[model samples]
Target: MTGANKQRVDVAIVGGGMAGASLALMLAHFCPHLSVALLEQRALPDADASVRLPSFDTRATAIAAGSLQLFSELGLWNQLRDYCAPIERIQVSDRGRPCGMSMRAAQQPRASFAGMLGAVVENAALGPVLHRALAQTQTQVLAPARVNRVRMVADGAQLDWSAGAGCPDTQLQAGLLVVADGADSPLCRGLGIVTERIEYRQRALVTTLGVQRDHRGTAYERFTDAGPMALLPLPRRDGSHRMALVWTCSEEDAAILRELPEHEFIARLQKRFGWRAGRIERAGRVSDYPLSLSLAREQWRRNLVLLGNCAHFLHPVAGQGFNLTLRDCYGLARALAGADLAQNSTVGLELLEAYGRDRRLDQQLTIGFSDRIPPLFASPGLFARGLRQAGLLALALTPPLRAGFVGQAAGFGL
Candidate 1:
């Protein structure tokens, strides 16, 4: 490639999944004057077509009320609401125990949106909506473009990428580089960003289920000896009631469950989950992912920042991972909204540092919340069981405790 082929932008984002796409949109909205480019290894879906990326698989994400407000700001709520099932209530329980707690949106109006605590949307549906919105923005979209190398430059960072094998590489220079590639990021590894990881030794089995009756806009969190399970309401399709399920269990148990016949699997699920959501009539394909708490040692450098799963990968038990990332994206976009990146090199560094400091408390609390819940409820010992019961009792009986829990879960005041 000749020097004339090299391109420069104010910011370049790697990875066009939910995190990258969202940060791109936010930058366009908040920092319209800044030139931005988004690069993705996978080809982006057409405006009217379905998305087929790793992030847009059969899994579903629970968008908290705060996140819904952020989407509304981006003018995506109208398109998203059509495909989402509102979560009007949340029920938390412990298996084989009679004590449990439930939270209703009516009880905490501040933690809800249009009387909804949150909403669940399948990632497949979410991806196209996001990409379609991106098509209208000024940010450059470079899909099927693989980044082979990245290095720090005097100005910022430079990325060498190609369309495919034997294709000439193109160099992209930017004032700031946002890395949103998924966990175990190659770019981060090349940048020498160390990650702290804690494997839970459990896998989350995910699938869509056909339920016998309506879920009534309720999401259930059930904790058992095996692990934690979540049943989130989903929009009805073809007149069939459906819900998304995330069941966490040991590797051995997951292996058995994956191989079980449909009837046997449903039977075991029904027995374990109880009659809360009524009978499970059917299930779609099941997929499993290993659970872990992964945090990057450095989220920001002089000319770089980490976003999404690359920055922090939290357990999904509290449904907080994506929401936290959304918050981080918003914070970073706001910090860089009107900065003069070209005229002042130190401006970017100062803003990135401030963003990191502002996000520290929220990230710590949310990560700790997601990490502690599974083991606390999964414990079989007498003391742990007693603590679980007491916790449930406090949440059920105390309004302050309930409100605090609802606010945190709903992504409010942070």
Candidate 2:
């Protein structure tokens, strides 16, 4: 082991996936004077678009318009514009049921979900753009390296990383450290931050499919006894129009769904999904994951703050995880600009406190929103089902309730 380098930076961020990378770029581009060091375990990918990404595993993200505006400000929107699809409207309902509610851009809209509220982008495709944006900025990226230990003290935060073989260990001391390592963050646990996780007994089978008819830029959310299924708009890739499908079902049933033949799987999906768009065809392979909500005991602690999944992992029914974390980055950046990172280093106690305070309302609301929707539509009991059905009918006919729903989707009126 080498001696401690004792290097220092204004902000040291661990976990360079979407959240950490975006934060580094935001800070460097918007607050250049602040020295930012981003630690990403994966090797920095080549920016050449001609390079082929792995097939049968293209994950799509529904990006809100506010997130797009952030990307646009970083000059990334134009780079990503060609590969993405806009969601001009979103249809929320219980799959195949005649009575339901819908929301469209023209009915009530905002700039955050793209022109409507959000745009869906392939995750693999977007990663490179964020990397490119970082490469062009002043941020110092320590790729293929990760923190082995995080020591939070009264004075400041100490980060120790074991570099790749043939490289060396690193010790970075910063006033503030952001943890975007993900929901199961080792750093958070190491810091004695207990996270509460609630298993929904559901799993989501995620994949893309070719629609029999045009999506017309509308995203669909339908709930069945199994769980809530969403078909989000996707750009035409590999010579076919695509939409990302997130199908939630009981853990055991999800396993059954995963083993079914492609044709059989699509047939069952069509039965519940109905033929709203026409004949549905599988566009890619499916990937399944457990669904849960994980919330940290606190968002900030002694010069360290958790962002993205590390802070809160939502059910994805509302498509709020990434967007909510981006807003955290937005809020923290503003807090730093308005206050002092230097003085707050020891605890950043004041800044962190404020960030925590401003973030709580949004966090609780989004988490609850995503958590409640699935159960509301999935319950089968006579009373529970009736209540949900009645609510849907009232929401469909009532203007105020419909407008409120739209406002919430637009990232406001919460």
Candidate 3:
């Protein structure tokens, strides 16, 4: 009903997932005078309930040091701190190799919170936290809304959408349009922005596992012949040590693994990951996603910008997908905060251009690292295997290089 009459805002975000919600918050904090609108397809559950968007499912994301600082700057870190589990150590190993590299929080000079490498927060907790924060802001949120059409007009972009179930169709006008609608964004396609996607021929199987021994704030990344298996630390209600598992494998192998019994699944997982974190006591629901490196050929158009997975989707190798986007959101917010919007209804081209230019290096590095590293470690070739093991050995032996790597992983490379 609210959209029945044309509503005008300075920024209209098409998807209210992490990136979109984050941008709304950033605007609310830094540019409170600017009117903002967010249109989301999924409706939030009742206040007491916690059903979350599929994008923000049960999967846990590794929050880098830089991201934590950014959240703190935005006054959001306190809200998320309770749900986070610190990643104090990371052990990277090859399945058949004799040696591996261990990155400790103490090894990096800048590591904070008693040498915390990073932190992990489950989506089930994060999504609601974000939505609640959005609710507290002045940004208008329209959920369970279906966007029927988007048109680029001379003044700005116009959205024809219907809010809620059986709601009447309404129109909205915005000076700038932000598309954070994930990788398969119809809006991006409609705008003739082609995606360059490289299929890795692998699928990521994700689940949470209860361990017999405490994880001790350590994350393990084991590179097996099948693919990479990463076990990130988590906290359980029963005071049990939980680890979030992200295992990459061939499609056929993934199919087999997904159907295996809990006991059998844990057995197989232990074989690949070893007894580093001790025996896996139990397994949770398993979910799988196809792995790919996808980038939008064009991220910006006149009065329009794309963010997050809509702009680029990276392999989950380093868990850099969300981290990179968070940085992008921060940059865009800074650009908007400093720009003079009084002269025009929409943000100026100069501001947009500068923002794009600023993000180019970070995007290229993050995307390239995610794209190249997975295959190098996952490769079955003898040369690739040797290279990976040797690289790990060198990293272990070289302190300066290791510190640099840690800094990069902390998202300080940009």
Candidate 4:
């Protein structure tokens, strides 16, 4: 601890993933007067340009339109535009049903161009982009730093951490603390935060595939007998039509599928995905993630506030986890920038309550979708399937309702 009169940072953000880095950049770039420091444990992100996903990690997140707008406002969507694939239409269906429910761009009131519902990018691509932006900002990046201790007191929040390999720990004091750590956040737990978590006995197998028919910016969400599967289009870089696949199934089935021969796995996927995209020629090495939903009782405590997966972790089936985190990050930045800095820190009860107030409904709505979809979509009985199919028909046949659903998926509903 510095006994000298050293200046304290206005905010110290822990974890430099998309949520942390994006928010840090916003705060530093817009309100540079507010001293902000971003702490990341990795010495550095991988520097190899040839490696897209790197080995062992193969997940991709579906970026929603609202988030894309937020990124656009931050002047980042343009940077990612070429790298991501636009989703022009979404087809939600019950495989056993008679037909599919489609929410198309033409239904919207747009005068020109299909209102892109959203875009999909390799998450591997996202980390590097945000990290690069973070590096460009004046915000201090504590590379290879670990949080050894965190203390929140009446005075302020204190963080003890070690930077560089084999180095002594250093202490930092901040008027506000941001916990942007992932799903299993130690900082939140260390502060005795309560979270509701559900472990579905399923795992999602994700990968990329080359298809015969062009995706034509069409994305498919199919409820299979085994589980739910989504096929999202990716923008072609080399005149090649590419698609990203997310297949959810029982854990045992996922393990078995992962072990199958490459051709065998592709065949299985083809049968489930059908001939809409023609032959499913190739499949990347699969990525597996256990499905779950986690929600922290409170997004803030004392001089501390939680954001991103640290605050709420949703089922990937809904693609709402990262989108929600981005919203939280932007909201936090907005809330901080609007407040009176002389009389209050960004970590005060009033600020926390205000953030909670503005965001609670949105969070709840997304959570409810994640919590509801899996069970309903995963139902085994014929009667349940019949009911779901009927709902799909309703959605497809009803123009106003279909547009509303499409708007939500496109990120325009909010």
**lDDT tens digits by residue: candidate 2, 1-414:** 345576877788999999998888778766776888899877888655543444346888888766777788778888888768888877777754667877676666543444566788888888888888788887888888868888875666888886777566788888788999987988888888899999998898999888777788888888887788889988876677678889888888888888889899999888878776568977468889999989898888767888889889999896888988887897888777777445324445777888788978877777888888788788778787878778888888997888776665555554
Cα displacement (angstroms), candidate 3, residue 17, comes to 1.0
Per-prediction RMSD in angstroms? 2.2, 2.2, 2.7, 2.8
User: Which candidate leads the pack in lDDT?
Assistant: 1
Better of 1 and 2 by lDDT: 1
Ordering by lDDT: 1, 3, 2, 4
Q: What is the TM-score of each candidate against the true structure?
A: 0.96, 0.93, 0.94, 0.92
lDDT of each: 0.90, 0.79, 0.85, 0.77
In terms of TM-score, which candidate is strongest?
Answer: 1
Off by over 4 Å in 4: 3-7, 46-58, 109-114, 237-239, 343-346
Over all chains combined, what TM-score does candidate 3 have? Answer: 0.94
lDDT of 1 at 17: 96
On the 0 to 100 scale, the lDDT of residue 78 in model 3 is 84
Candidates sorted by TM-score, best first:
1, 3, 2, 4
Number of backbone-clashing residue pairs for each candidate, in the order shown: 0, 8, 0, 0
Deviation in Å, model 2, residue 301 alpha carbon: 1.0
